[model samples]
Target: MPTSNWNIMVKASQNPPFAAENYSIAEIKNEVLLQIRSGKDFPVTSAAISLIGQLTSEQEVPVAELANVVLGDYGLTSKLLKLINSVYYLRFGEVTTVSRAIVLLGTDHLRDVALSFTLFERLQTDASDHIINLLCRAVYAAVVGRRIASQTGYTNPEEAFICSLFHTLGEMLTAYYAPGTYAALSKGITGSGAEESARVRTSLLYLSLGKEIAQSWRFPARIVCCMEKPTVKMSEHDDVYRLSCIASGANEVAHIVEESLDPEDRQRKLEKTLKNVHLSASLISGNGDLTAPVEDVHKYCSLYGITFERSAIARSLNQRREENEQAQGPLKRPTNNTAEDAPFDLPPNFNGSSSSPFSSLPEAQDDSETVFTNGLREVGDAFLEECPLDDLLTIILETMYRGLKPFGLRRTLLLIRDARRPAMEVRLSLGDPLASIKSWFSIPITAIGSDVFNIALSEQKHLFVNDSTVPPIDGQPLIPSWLVEHIDRPVAMGVLPLHIKRVSIGMIYLEGEKNFFTTVPQNYLNYVKILHQQAAIAIRQR
Candidate 1:
């Protein structure tokens, strides 16, 4: 359901003389926009729409700019990082920075990912079954389209994904903005023209509305073109036309998969659709595995947090896979007796043993160690990729924050020397979100002081205070009075100075509760120092 005004307007359009035919396309488009704006969540929706437009625009957006946009949205940043680190993209190793992700995944793929997330967030607020089904189909189509593009050797599979995902944008928006009209259109009305004409008009209404919105959102020309249904006979050589065919064919395949038809019927319909689009049957059954794409769909659904089990398409696809597997029977192993062809098996002495030999081995590394190891590897990869300075610094800081969590890491801040000022200021922070505390991170470089922070930076050394409240034998406090007044005496703290060619530039400030530093293992502390070294290296390289 939509706003009352839009519902009334759509319901009124079904009457004689005031029907949809009487209204110009422009009028309908304006009404749609107005109704969308009139909704209660328009402000949030408008911002998301604007972000999608920026992400998907045709112009070349700088990596830093794109990374900045993504970093501004905490949820999107977290999800995007999670997706990049998922098994799907794990071949690229761990990506800790948005800029690195954009570089590895390409702007097109990340743009589509961002767009899908934005649309899902905006439309799923009051989503009904219809909306959920549409969203699933959209994602399913994108996955299928990417497969088709890869099979056909298209230059950009991600572009194909975007085209296919947005193909149903108009229908989805219609269902959200004017469910009554969408329902009425779903059940066709008796018209004077041929059934095909009526069908064409109905399809055009949705496509045209989608095109209008695409234009408003500044989506690329190829995406808008793919939104339209392909002509009866399209040129296979034209890239845009080929993408359009792929999108249309993929969407049709999605519909066929969801149908109540038997496996044979569904296969026949799928083949027919692919043939009409000039695609090979191999796309459907690559290497005789018909369920690969279905499995991929499920993986993507998990990444997007969509409940694939609830989808009719998922059920149908699973049923098809089961039937295919049943027909193939149980797999038989090779009977060859050659030593090289022998199957892997456990030792005879261990097979029937009650106790396991591995029981005496040391346990696996803890989560914090894994985090530190992964962070180190990610930093190494970033260096190999020649990651931009800002992004590399972000990775270093984030690594330290996450890896030190087991040691009660409360907040970590990167304070860099201001180029035009006599003081260092907080450039990046993690694990804390208090603006007041963040602002207090500034340290005047020229101020004569021997406190822990100043000492670390001036001497280019690392300082770890196990208990800030205990004064040294000199009867002078190590913790500065200003820090005590503002932060109310942090129980523990660590400072690692950043230097370029032996000249101090800044310091990393870590604050936590009691036993933060006392509890940290020597190896973990070494890992933190390694991360600090990487930050210094990044700064030197820059």
Candidate 2:
């Protein structure tokens, strides 16, 4: 599915009227879940439901089995791996595989990652700007919750993350599954007299519906508890109550940040909200720096592929940062040199762009190289940290997939030798139409015969064919006939072999469009080789 804003209003006219006042909460909850389950995105919903069940089951789920469940979905696997490797979770080093991530970060963290992605996936459909804004607020709340958990030394910060993320589940789902009713309730609850009753009823409806979904999804008892507005005063000794406070407070802060334009008004509202929850501003920002939480929100947005600039909360936060910076004025640098002593002369014959040769390249290509360079650094870090073999290989493959994207990299396949059979099969792939081509990419290995792919594996050499249709001097085509018959003949291709203790394991197959490998820099090719060598080292270590 395409990653875009979710369009809840697309089927709004077709939706039945969801009058919360008429039916019992149970009836309404069941109806909503049924509607969601029967909708067009049921397959995605079902998969998420199944994964949640496995993660939260009473019986112990084996590490390998759990990892398999996660890896079964391409998007989930990609996002989960990325989340685990993010700065927030990167404690030991780079985590590559779901199994190793489970071992290192624990199952609770993995469960939260899965939940976060599921929520993100649901809200990411093509939608109105308002709905997208709501989604951004939820993400902001979750990020704040995680930070609060960390600052307060909470044992399970992931729990805090999930609690805060789903804090507005009731409101968000109502908006998504029943936009008309949401709009009606939203409008009706904004005044005195009968409006106050409407407000109370609306709150109850949202809260009850959210609770029902949580219960149906088998969310932990504590999470469900945290979803509700805390009615009682928080006790210092009650950790769960404190956690609930954090979740609720973070959610309120998210709303305040988005809804309030004036910094003073926002800060005052934030302070009041935190005070009501028995939390201090310092708990969120250790030094009472209000802008800290806002910066963290932007950082998390970047980490999760969210368009930070488009978020209303982000704009509000930016304003707050600007105001705060202006209030404090610019900082003075501690310089030992006088104004005349400081060197300010430009080098001889130096143009602004003379410092880097890449200045002449397109911005996208430069960004691509930067991504590849970062990927190489990550792989090197993983090696130093002795990251699990499977995880390291995944990182390497994902890096190559993302880095080569600018070169018209359409599909990347990792064909590994099956231990039990003399055949190379597609172990992993990245890019579109994978289901169509993944199954057809098996190559039989034989001592007597030679194909370009087999030859690269056997000889442990890299091959770059700019155009597969052109016959080499040997009059042999680089791409096998079977491949051409099953899939579109790629205009350009790259084959980098992987080895373990001098024995061939697999090769990374990169397929692209016209002139794919022609203009790529030598340094980029060297980076690719380094990534392959890192994979080899990982294999040998295994």
Best by the TM-score measure: 1
Task: Give one digit per residue, the lDDT tens place, for model 2 in 316-427.
Answer: 5555545545877642333684422222112223222322321222232226676677677767777777876656676677667666766777777777899999988876
Note the Cα lDDT for every prediction shown.
0.68, 0.65
Residue-by-residue lDDT tens digits, candidate 1, 69-105: 6655666776787777765576887565555677788
What TM-scores do the predictions have? 0.67, 0.60
- Backbone clashes, each candidate: 0, 9
Give candidate 2's whole-model lDDT: 0.65
Q: Of the candidates shown, which would achieve the greatest lDDT relative to the real structure?
A: 1
Give me the displacement of residue 529 in model 2, in angstroms: 2.6
